[model samples]
Target chain A: MNEKLHPFHIMILIYMNQTGVVIMSLPHLLAENFGYNGWLGVILISLVVNLNIFIISIVYRLGKGKSIFQIMESSLPRVITFPIYMILIGVWSMTGCMVIKNYVYIYQIMSYNTTHAMLLKLLIDIIAYLLIIKGIYTISKAATSFFWITSWMLLLQLFFIKDFEWARLTPFLFKGDTHFLTGGFIVFTAFLGYELCFMLFPYADNPKKFIKSVYKGNLITTLTYLIFCLICFGFYSFEQIRNMMYPLLDLLSYIRLPFIERIENLLFGFFLFTTIVSVVLYSWSAQETFARIVPKANKKVLAFIILTFGYIVAWFPDTLSEVGQWLQYLGYAELGVAFGLPLLLILILVIHKGAKPS
Target chain B: MRTMPKAAALLLVIVIIAGCGDQRILEKQGFIQSTGYDLNGTKNDEKDNRLMITVDIPKSDPEQRMQRETLTAIAHSSKEAKILFAGQTELSLVSGQLRSTLFGVSLAKTGIWKHIDTLVRDPSISQRVKIVVVNGRAHDLLVRDYPQHPRAGQYIDRMLEKESALMSFPLVTIYDFSRDYFDDGIEPIAPIIRENKKNISFDGIALFKKDRYITKIESKQSLIFSMMKQNFKKGEISMKLGDGSKKQEYLLFSSVISNRNVKVKRSTKGNFNIQINIVVKGSVLEYSGSHELSKDYDRKKIEKRMAEYIENEAAALMATMQKHNVDSLGIGRNVRNSLSYEEWNKLDWNKEYPDADIRISARIVIKDFGKFK
Candidate 1:
């Protein structure tokens, strides 16, 4: 392939992936565990997640000439790498569909209904399949275009600034040791997309700047999470934050302009774009990994098969609450893959380095 | 040709699905703009969960004057009441545009949290819906027609909106009320309104002890309480000036800009004392005092007197709220944040609130002796 992704493109891709449907539930999670000290908790977790990204960065640095899948195939025995790839593909495919299920749930409640949930899920799957088959270069180009326009959604929080009560965060760090740590753990779930770092490593044209690009992406997302956490915390009392299911959408409902009515409904439609990109990234990663098992097949065909698998996973949940439980399971599985794989990959590199001729 | 035909069939199916939305046209749907709830029976009827609900909907015709329809029913919940209303009304009753919900004094004092759950659960209702407490049966106020004001929903909405903006009272949306209700150390308060022979108007604020309304602050000093909680812009604070011997006895300050700073201090004995300082900057719209307007010392004396009066009034307002054991000012919230979680949970702020040593002071500055001086 002549076309290669720039480090900047990789950064934008990872950035988009980190901040999808998960941001809606974040403030409530933090507030449930930590009281007014939720802001501090968010900052602490962002740093820890950054540390996890550093582990992925080490994987990028060690595997200089190859993709992470290629590196794994070469470095480890088939016994280990095979199960790891299978587990990753399973988790990624389920998680991708889970994002769509969540988006459909939001759509069902917010908009006057038209299509049935199954039909909506199928539509999402088809759109995602079309995009995923276009390959990574095209996906990155889409992400780049999307990163500029959708970022203005952050500016919507500015309308709530006059109503923000800073006292909601006053006398910070008043919570106990256990609550603070637990809050950090909850926030870590929100920063799950950085695991894509390992997958996107070989795509960067200048491989040396890979770490810098990843860090840049992580920082911008961290800053995004931090700004939103502050806005939500300040905009609501601590109790209000606890009761809110989707804080960003609730915040959007407050705005009314001369030109617009029900701004949140419009924005929810806009966030549909972000949700599509997120699912596309995860399912595409799954397709690439699953392609190894059937090397003779076309990747475009493989992507369709993976997209069908996502549709089946999405169908398993009968209701919104059931879907939430499924997402919780996906989140735990993701944590396992996100934290465990990078650390294991880095360890193999360390051992490989130690056993060298020098 | 076969592939193209299959694609077109699929596209048609999807298009049909897209257009088959839950139909709720403006003319066909009854949009409940405002609702009022009153306790159904006598005050002693404890077991009766029944409520009398009154809903007001705006007329669709542009040419019609005072064109609003009201439906009243005895139902168990706001949702049930809506179902009952739909049975009686021509159009389907929906709460999509629910702008105001008022609780009668009897219902409010009994508790409104359970009744408000329907509003919170309904995905269509906006959190911006104004929640108010009416002194008499809210149904009485909801049914009355004002030919001059036309739509009571719009009138009441504009009344609450304008009063809150002008600093007559705080803007207590259901979101705000729930926030304070759910918080550990704070309490919720809402605009208390009552109707007289002349018309319906804002009376004061109804303070709550948890979900139940415990007491109220009169409309006169509501602005002062509002300022203590937050800053107020474009207010008018008028005071009685001279003794009964004087014919002219009032001073009015308009275009008011005021702010408050509340500080909580703890002594070595583990006691919390609150110090509140309110600063008011406004122009003198009118003065009936004997002091010369042009003189500096007289102006200083007037400012000092205004400060003293405001400080006294502040003390009285705090006393009233404290007497009810309501921490509507969020003094307890401040004290809670100052301690660790363990320490905060251990302290019962409600027990401590009524007797807390709180000092309130005011510093008033009159920028203009007359309008645009």
Candidate 2:
């Protein structure tokens, strides 16, 4: 399946993974943690995520044409590997659930107002099921199309700068070095999509193009996030920016044209496409891990089960704070897999080479 | 497979559920055009904090001569009053079309930050909606049917928008207010509207020391204030030009081009002196004076005289504002931009601004001084 993805298509998949429901309320998280100095936070987070991507690409070189599953099978025992596979599956499925839940909640707030949560979840699950059954090839093609779907989002930012106060980004010198480090870790979960590169790298048409394509994808995500942060900073007060749960939507409401009354509703409706791609990709990855573990099991059945499990678990969090708590724990686990695993594997490989008298 | 019917049934169920939710029929909902908030009392009682909300909605039939409905209520907050308004209207009222909000003098002085927070939090309201301070009770204006635009909200909104672009007042939106209110070195300023000649008109500018209204400047002073702060698309400055003897005559300077720059520097005593430089380029539209302006030297003399007068007036306005410790001109913001974050945090702007020296100097070019001798 390495031949299925072109190098450029990898960028689209990574971009889709990087941006979604998370970017909607990003200003809230960044401003709460960093104040007027979030530009520094953007720099620091990108630096760390870039380091993670580099290490993962190194792991790919070590794979030596072996898929991640094959590499793990050759290096570790089944007992150790089996639990790791289960954790990955759980992570992918749980994160997909969070994305679905958050996007649905935001949609209700912005559009429907009082939609039945179960119905929204059912609709998303069915769509994701249909797409996931077609597998990665279709998902990648959908992601490529979704790239065009969402490319118009940044145009809204251009019209919005007329209200921007350049002085809002004032006192431009960086002072809070420690706050940047803390803020970097605080928003570490937002940079989770690039971590998918490690698993998806072996599936690229050329693993040699994986590093550059992933970095380019990561760069696009970073710049997009930076623009959003700076625009929110310029357009909103520190306290206002800090308090707004959805600054971008609030900003969109500011754009008053005679023809359109509720632009955010329509925009958020289009954003559902990005969410579909996200949930399907996550469940599809979980599908891959499921097949590797069972080997002889029916994969389509497993994929549907994974998506259904996400839809069911998404309803358990009755409160937003519960979702926050879940995501906080999930963020830590995600960081462990993104950074801790690759670094540990590199160390193990280094020692193994040494012991083998290479 | 036996799953095709199950899938079709599921899809049908989802579609039915989606269409069964709330239907926001446009005609059945009252679209609030403007809102007015005033404090009920003056003390620490809950009644003191009780907010009186006045909302204006226009008639759907455009041909109706008297075309507006005014809803007034007293409640704990704007949100509460909105909920209480359901009893008064046959249609459900929605606030998505809100054009402007006016706060009574007492409410503004008491502090309107919390009220502003409610506006910003509501996703339905537009951030471009103007916020103003009324000279008297806010509800008074909402009830008056002006001759030009019977709806008080549309009248006030159009007046504010036009004046903001073509006259003396600054364009103050909810977005601008929130930005200035939260910044450490600046404070928000909005236009003041008052009952004049049985109709509402822009009276001046309401200045704030933080969120509380401190004082206001009349339209004449507000002209220079607006000029010193932002660029104008077009406006006029009219004033009496001399001592009450023969030189005292009216002059209207129109087609005005002006800009301002503030420089913060250390004086000889190591204290800060902010130098404000203003340049005005305008042609005299009306001159009732007897002075000859055809000569170049006379034109130079008139230009110099106008410059001196503006400089003196602007300086006096700044001195009065400094007496009240108001930084509505953003001098503190300009100075703060020049320092490190630590230094900015350490400096007390409130203390420094009152005692700080401000100098305003102007140069009026008088592009084409009027029609004739």
Candidate 3:
């Protein structure tokens, strides 16, 4: 619990959390919203996320590197802060459970149709639980390893360059349907996991250096998203991408080597590492929020409670669409907390400073 | 703590064992390599089946690895046929290894979208599986055994792969088919194969308007269409050029590299004029023309003649496509790019494709002659 994460670990942790299971369907979402050359919208979305990151950095500076709970509780009334903590706990744990649930749903659909989905999700949950019990420092260390394991997947994009066509990208800019609102929202949600960084203030030795690592982590994630979206746009036509359920998976399936075929199955299995990291991180955040509320609770017991709560909740959505619906709602709520929490903290800090001179 | 470790180990053991329940035994699973769909032409009032589906499942036994078990079922849907197929085989039929899907000419003429939609929907099926059109009954093609090709399914798969690489015909997978089918600017196409004597042969390029097979490009003219359709580094094209007074002149170019450029301009009317320019460079492997290859000027004359021959052939090819109202060359894509978004949306490309004036020109450069020259 006393260990602090290195700047490199922080960077890779943020990158891993941002990438989760959404990457497989991201190309289809972009094509649906922005049409041809919709990949250009990722840069715009990334800038908005960077602005959010900037806001969080401001909170870190104004609060003098104190924990977010410390800053909020000291200024706000217990009545106001208590419900905010409850909402954060609900939103974060639900997001955590939904991420794994969505992954397991897709896994069952792609590989194990006969296997029980909850059984599969339970297996994933157990793996995530083993990691979450170790705390954030260990999770960050494990995340650095997961980052190395999954980042090499971007190199597979090279295989598509032979068939990639500029004409398929088209000459139009943002020529898709009127669904840009939902598209922007979905793309915005892909960047949602970074907002959990505010919970990491106490774990940072230097707040200024930690914020820099967050930006670096976000840069890596944005580039990864940009590369994937561009390859999918150029490899598949606008209409084909729109019709595909998971264009990235299909692209991976098309890769055939002399020794191996259907590498998508293996690569998708490797994605388990990143998914586990994301699940553990989100659950850890929820557990930390729980600890703030109940100061005397055991950390391990709190983690168990959160995981059990998540496991029970995962049973309701037996199908992929249902899981996806819940995830979309949770994503929207997290996005609200991501922006709202920081602005609220800044409001408290400014009022406190104005009310009493230093 | 010791009991906890033991409990964890027991849990791991149970999970490891329970996870094996979903394991698929290789010998027990019958992998369908080739599937053929044909319209039932027989008049059987009792069994009103629209589709005659045939599958080639290779035997798992090493001694009979070369042999395949062919199963045929008549059902309205592919899944229905799949259930019927499962009843005949002890081995569980799976489509994870499906390599090629063949549609009979009769069935293809009607439209293949519904069957293709099912294949696309199945998560187990690969997107790279070759989509082929059969000139004869697809049932006949799959049912017969070729003497020379011990494993006909594997032979067809390898042949399509090699031919597609040689640019004899474009390789149209399910991914390509659906991509072009969905794109408003271009239509889809597939290669046609037929049973010829003891083996299967590449017939030609099958053209489609939407999902129905409209026409075909003859094998001889397939090279011309391939050149205009895409840019490739290697292919072969043979052309015949001469006057009535001279001996019949024929030139065959090997390792032909071709690059195509399409320019679209709005004509005086509300229609469009499309200009296609193809630059080809090749080494002469066989020349029976009057021009002497040893001389630069004579070689230039042969090049000019070959260029002229290609231009005329492409013009004829474009005319045939326009006559049938099939924009197989993706000329509509270029025209769409030339217009604004609203104009492209309002215009019916299929209607404007035939009325638009199209021209083709070829520039051929002989990079190398043979050692004989």
Give the number of the best model, judged by TM-score: 3
Model 2 interface RMSD, in angstroms? 2.0
Taking all chains together, each candidate's TM-score versus the true structure is: 0.94, 0.92, 0.97
Highest DockQ among the candidates is held by which one? 3
Residue B308 error for model 1, in Å? 1.7
**lDDT (Cα, tens digit) per residue for candidate 1, span B46-96:** 788799999999878677563778999999887888788888978888777
Residues A201-300, candidate 1: write the lDDT tens digits: 6667887787788788888888888888888887788777777787777776767676854567777887777778888999989998988767799998
Better of 2 and 3 by lDDT: 3
Task: For model 1, state the Cα shift of residue A15 in Å.
Answer: 1.1
Best by lDDT: 3
Displacement of the residue B225 alpha carbon in candidate 2, Å? 0.8
Q: DockQ of each candidate's interface versus the true one?
A: 0.52, 0.60, 0.63
Tens-place lDDT digits, model 2, residues A227-276: 88888887776667676788878877777677875577777787888777
Steric clashes per prediction: 0, 0, 0
Output candidate 1 Cα RMSD: 2.9
lDDT of 3 by residue, B241-306 (tens): 876688889888999899999999896778687899999998998998767998999988888888
Q: Candidate 2: misplaced stretches above 4 Å? A: A172-182, A347-358, B1-13, B42-49, B61-66, B243-246, B267-270, B288-296, B367-373
Q: After superposition, how far is residue A68 of candidate 2 from its true place, in Å?
A: 0.6
